[model samples]
Target: MARELMKGNEAVAEAAVRAGVAAYFGYPITPQTELLEYMSRRMPELGRAFVQAESELAAVNMVYGAACTGQRVMSSSSSPGVSLMMEGVSYIAGTELPMVLVDVMRGGPGLGNIAPAQGDYNQIVHGGGHGDYHSIVLAPANVQEAVDFMALAFDLAEKYRSVTVVLMDGMLGQMMEPCELPAMLPMKTEFPDWAVTGAKGRERRFLTSINLNPTQQEITNLRMLNRWAQVEANEIRYREYFMEDAKYAVVAYGSAGRISLSAVRTARAEGIKVGLLRPITLSPFPREAIYQASRKLDGMLVVEMSSGQMLDDVLAATRFTVPTEFCARIGGVVPYPDEVLDSIRNLVKGPLTTEGHPRDRWLKRMAERN
Candidate 1:
């Protein structure tokens, strides 16, 4: 396929269409609105279903309804909009329905801004929706990655009968890059046996997130847990850069990962033996890989566009075996490559300790710098 210069959100939307997405339901929100706009035009042209719902709540529920029929379905929104859909997201998870969601994250604790940010790390990766269920989350660093993960998202969702989230910051959503999209896939013709399509020919089937009896609810929860175990074993994904011979490393994801990569390269040129670990899957979180990397490192630096959310996960994975430091630019501010390079320089300078919380230390450093 010939490569085309495309905006991240539109490219991902087209990727979903080519992946045979049968229906799309979403509301317009900045940084991610282009995705919905693309779907509105393309879905109808392909004779597929598309709905620009009144609100995120309505959109997610519409996705929920379509998913129950065993068709490929999805929804997209920015940070605050995603919050509105949390309840419906939980309902979908509890029912073990297969669906995909794209979260083009923006700055926020509440109505922050439309700028690119990784602040949704905790919300999306840690199951923002109320439930004991887990969603498979994919973080893409660039437009190419954002485009490619769209098909994989649907495949994984259906494979595990779970929700799959393509998590990206607003920068990735709005930036333009050259990428080759996948070939169009045929729409699914055979519905799953569990589908709630008309029951005229077969036995009437039912699916619900509600398990009234306590024992039944427990059983449902157990089933979801067991399935998640399979996901953890088989789905962990991450990318390593220049780690073949390194004494120190940087951990980051999504756009932050992309930025950190540049810093790592510059640091390498300056005789700093530092590499990058960019997580591709945030849920089945490359824990084992990080643990192994920690075993060989003197210290690690975590870079983020948020307030060190993923840093906590890295700390747990490494079990504090290696001294760790953190640097971040939260609330719509993106850290420059030079800033991360400076952090790398500091990481090599020593006095790094595994004592108190990395965030606490980072806060002190940030305060001093300001």
Candidate 2:
């Protein structure tokens, strides 16, 4: 297939279509509205289901309903909008339904802005909904990755019978890049045994998240926990650059990781032994890889578009044995490669220590700079 220049959001929509997504239900939200817009036109042309629901809540519930039928269903929303869908997300997870969700993160703890940010790391990666559930979260750093992960999201969701999220920032959502979308997949003719399809001549199947009995709920929770263990064992993914002989490294994900690559390259050019580690799966984070790298490195730098959210994970992964520094551009501000490069330079020059929290030190640095 020929690679064509495509906007990130539109490419993801087309990718999902090619992946045999049977239904799409979403509300218009910036940085991701193009995804819904594309689906609105394309889904109808392909005879698939598409609905621009009245709100995010309605949209997620529609996805939940479609997922119960064992169909490939999805919804896309930005930060504030996704927040509105939390209850439905929890419901879908508790019922052990498979569904895909794309979260094109924008600035926020609230309706902050339509600019790119990684503020939703904790929300999406840590299961924003109220429940003992886990979402298989994939963080893609570019348009190509965003497109590719759409199909993978569905596969993983079905494989684990759980929610899967394609987590990218607004930058990746709105940016354009050359990518080759996957070939169109034929929709499934056979439904899973657990599907809530009509009980025509067979046993009536029922699917619900509600478990009134405490013992039953505990069993369900244990089932989910065991499934999650399988995910952790089989699915941790990450990419490394210039790390074979490096003394220092930068750990990031999504857009921040993409930008950090440039810094890592520049640092190498200056004869500084620095590398990069970008996590592909944020939920089943590549803890072992980071821990292994920490054993050989003098220090690590974490870069993000949020206030040290992923940083917490990195610190725990390394057991705080190696000194770690942080650089962040929060509230819609995207940090430039030079900023990360500076952080790398500091990491090399530091009397690095693991005594205090990396965020606290980063906060002190931020105050000093301002």
Candidate 3:
């Protein structure tokens, strides 16, 4: 495929069309407004359904309704907008409808700002919606990955009959980069009998998130858990950069991983042994990869745009067996390559000691700043 320079959001919208997404219902929110805008124009041109919903809640519910007909459906939003869509997301999950959501995240606690940040880590990965459910979360570091993962997101959602989220920060969404768009995927041929598409001369079908019967709901929850376990076993994805012979490592994802890769390259050139472990799948995190990588490293640094979200996963992956350090930027601030390089230098400067938890070190740093 020919490479084209494109903004991440635009690439995602186009990718969805080529991936055969039948409908897109979304409300505009920055850093991802371009996604909805692109879909609005292109989906209409492609003869696909498109709706500029009045609110995120309405948008997600529309996704729910479209998905019930077994159509490839999607929605996009930033942090606060995603929060508004949580109730609908819960319903979608409970009902076991397959759909894709793109989160071009911005700084947040509450309408924080229109800047890149990984503030929605917990909300999206750890069941933002209620009940025991998981979303297949893919965090793409660049425009190409964003385009590629947008297609993968739909495939996985259908394969698992669950929500799949492409979690990109605002930086990736707004930045223009060269991307090689993938070939168009064929529309899904196997439609479930449960899909509600006109029951003329056939039995009626119904899909509902509500399960008033306690025992039946428990059974449903158990089934969801089993499916999640299957996803974890088969769907973990990540990239290891210069891990061989490295004594120090930095673990990051999304745009932060992109920046950390540069820091690792710089550190390596300076005779400081550094590598990067970038997780592509955020929900079924590459825990085994982190563990194996930590085995050879003297220390690890987790860089993030938020205070420390994926940092927890890195720590979990390391089992606190390796010394881990954290460097973060929040409220629209992004840590530069120099800042990551400094953190790498600081982490490897001292003697390696596997002492108390990494959180203590993070807290000590916070205390010093305060």
Candidate 4:
């Protein structure tokens, strides 16, 4: 395929269309609004279904309906908008529907500003919905990753019979970059008898989580757990750099990670032996990769836009591997390269953790950490 320069949002829409997404339903939100616009223009041209929903909730429910028909459906929104879709996200998980959600995240809490914030890290990785459910979340760093990740999201969603999320930030959603996309695959829209479209030829498929009976709900929960365990065993992804010869490492993903990687190169030129452990799949969270890298490196730096939602994952993953310095900047602001460089500079000398200074873990509790 010919290489071309395109914005991240456009790349994702093209990727979805080419990779066999049957339908897309979404509401416009900042940062990711361009993505919907792109899909609106192109999906119809390709004969794919696209709906500009009345609201985020309606769009997500539309996803649920189409997913019930076994369509390769997707939806996109910013952080606050994603929060609005959490209920539907949980329902999708409980019903074990194969679908994709793209969260081109902006700032959080409640209508926080839109710039480029990784504040949605915890929400995306930890199942922002209410329940013991997990989505196969993919965090793409640049425009290319945005395109590449959408396909991965679809594959994983179908493979595990679960929801998958593509979590990007504003910079990733807005930036333009070169991409050599893979050849297009044949699209499929085969709805199985298990789907809840109608009783039709195969009895009736009950695609729902509303089990009012205690025994039924327990059974449903157990089924979801079994599926989750299987997913953990089979689905996990990450990207590693400079591990062959490195003393320190930084952990980040989405835009925060891409920039941290550039900073890693800068640190390398300055004789600082730094590396990066970027999480591509955030739910099955590449725990083994994290442990392996932490075992080899002297120290790790957890750099993120939020107060450090990803930092806790580092500590949990590296409990016996290595110590990590928690680095973060929250709200609508992002961490600059200098800040990441500074963290790497510190990691070059010593280990950093909660005990060293007492406040760098729970992001919401800022006063406690600083």
Candidate 5:
């Protein structure tokens, strides 16, 4: 199909259909309600299953059931709604089911605002429910990337038999951009050997998350950890810009990354050697990349919509070797390019104390913001 203007949420829905998603079960929530609305109309026309589930909890459970049948199933919601589905998501992960979940994140501590925020980073990437588990988290910087990642999400889920999450902010879901839509992928009707289809001319098989045997549970835990290690080794992805001979680097992901790119360019224009590192996957984070980049850079800046959740990972990546600073706009507000530019300027040119730390200088700049 020719490139056409599409809302980010609509593009995600279209891409899922093109990626051969067989079933969709979702409850409407702000900034992402259009995603479910799009699927509701399109899935039926494509002869696929679509359910406007009674609630977020029920929606995720429906996805879990469909995933067990070896079908490409999906569910989506915003922050608060996603919270309700965490228990179901944890169960799906425990069962080693392949499923795609989209989180068009909004600000939240409780029923917050229907505005963009990356506050869900810790909850989604680090496992919100009770278990030692990790979801393959994809953070797209634009609508096109979000569309492209939909196919990748399903591919990675099926390949590893793991849950994959596409993380987007509320703005990315509501904004419109020109997108080159992916072609339709052929649907699969045959079930996998591990799928829990009824026994027919074969021995009985069981699929359960309850491993009552302590030793067996340990073995399962080790297997999952090993699988995650492989994912970390092979699935980590990131994009870098203007790193050669840079004095400082800025790290951001998703919508924040897109905004920071503009700030990077602005900083460069003002004679600051600022570079950007955009992480595509949050789980298998680009640690090695950051480590290598930190060796040459004088300092690092972490920009986010949240109160520096991803910054912890950035600090760990650099081994706290370089002076790092953070800037954020919380409570559903997005940082302007000028605001990020100011942060970069402070990191690059602001006065450092006797200890040569940027904290005093960065704090002074932050205080000026008020």
Candidate 6:
């Protein structure tokens, strides 16, 4: 209602209540513990339902059960726990259920430490579950955007009648920021008559992805692909800053995007022509925006917490008309301003720093502290 200090996970929880989420089912996991904590308190206040299922696996299935009734539901977890939920996500997507999931990512191919990381980018955006289904993935750069994006995720999920996700990291979830969310909008979405709720007078309806008939399965796959094409036509979203008169473009998302914004401004002030392109929607990613940037800039620099995830999309969008450079920080560290600015300077630069480079200097500082 009013502006207040909140963490990114807290904002997601608050936004869930405001988005008219009918049910929440989740199990505990770190980096996202606050999200569950917030829901534990607020879901009761709204007379809604909240259940901590036996495990992440069960929690996701519970969400599936609720969504089968055509109720809006959500669940949240970290990397390891989310891996367990993959089986259920596949089921939900195969049946084409409309539900939202929040993933506060941490490092790993396994049970990693409780720190921020973007290693899940491919898994979250590329459909981690088996099969050919993609979730509508939203990437938010700050606490405010995180709150705003989660609301958007709900709308898209129900609109496409598909699963959607808000992909964020530990920095956003654990840090504090100002937020003023609006009043909860009343949701009035309905299940199609084809949906199998109970089947009273007509023939019984079924919800299953299994089609033993090859021809029928082909028909279903093509239909889903067509829907994805329609979504791709309308779903790309992005934000740009100081790029109208830019010689170079920088592509980044989430907290890295925010850091890149400051670096672009800093580079400009130092007489180097640099600008930023930040993607808000990771799936059907902001391709058109990237193509527009490539038309004007010489080359674009792609930065991320993990190696080469977002860059792949940038290259696909631009198709190599412009050269690209990449810089990344793995294992949960934010990209330093100097490293980004140094990328600009390497090709074309202004005499601003006589002290080698900012990232090298910062890394040494980190080494000393450790």
Per-candidate total of colliding backbone pairs:
0, 0, 0, 1, 0, 0
Give one digit per residue, the lDDT tens place, for model 5 in 1-370: 6899999999999999999999999999998999999999999999999999999999999999889889899999999999999999989888888989999999987999999999999999889878878899999999999999999999999988889999999999999999999999999878788887788889876767788998998888888889889899889999999988788999999999999999999999988888999999998899999999998888888999997789888888988887888888888999999999988887777442224433444456668867
Query: Where does candidate 5 have its weakest 10-residue lDDT segment?
Result: 352-361
Q: Which stretches of candidate 2 lie over 4 Å from their true place?
A: none
Task: Report residue 289 deviation for candidate 4 (angstroms).
Answer: 2.1
Candidate 2 per-residue lDDT, tens place, 317-357, comes to 99989999999999999999999999999999998998988
**In model 4, where is the ten-residue run with the lowest total lDDT?**
356-365
Candidate 1 lDDT, 152-269, residue by residue in tens: 9999999999999999889999999999999999999988889999898789999889988999999999999999999999999999999989899999999999999999999999
State residue 161's C-alpha deviation in candidate 5, in Å: 1.0
lDDT string, candidate 3, 1-370, tens digits:
7999999999999999899999999998998999999998999897889999999999999999999999899999999999999999999999999989999999988979999999999999898988889999999999999999988898899889999999998999999999998887787777887798989899889999889999999999999999999999999999989989888999999999999999999999999988898999999999998999898888899998877778878888888899888888778888899989988998988656677665567668768877
User: lDDT for each of the candidates?
Assistant: 0.94, 0.95, 0.91, 0.83, 0.90, 0.83
lDDT of prediction 2:
0.95
- The TM-score values for the models, in the order shown, are 0.99, 0.99, 0.97, 0.92, 0.96, 0.91
Give the higher-lDDT candidate: 2 or 5.
2
Instruction: Give the clashing residue pairs of candidate 6, or none.
Output: none
Alpha carbon RMSD to native, model 4: 2.8
Q: What lDDT is reached at residue 165 by model 5? A: 97
RMSD of each: 0.7, 0.7, 1.5, 2.8, 1.8, 4.5
lDDT of 2 at 218: 100
Off by over 4 Å in 6: 187-189, 201-203, 347-370
Candidate 4 regions with alpha-carbon error over 4 angstroms: 351-354, 357-370
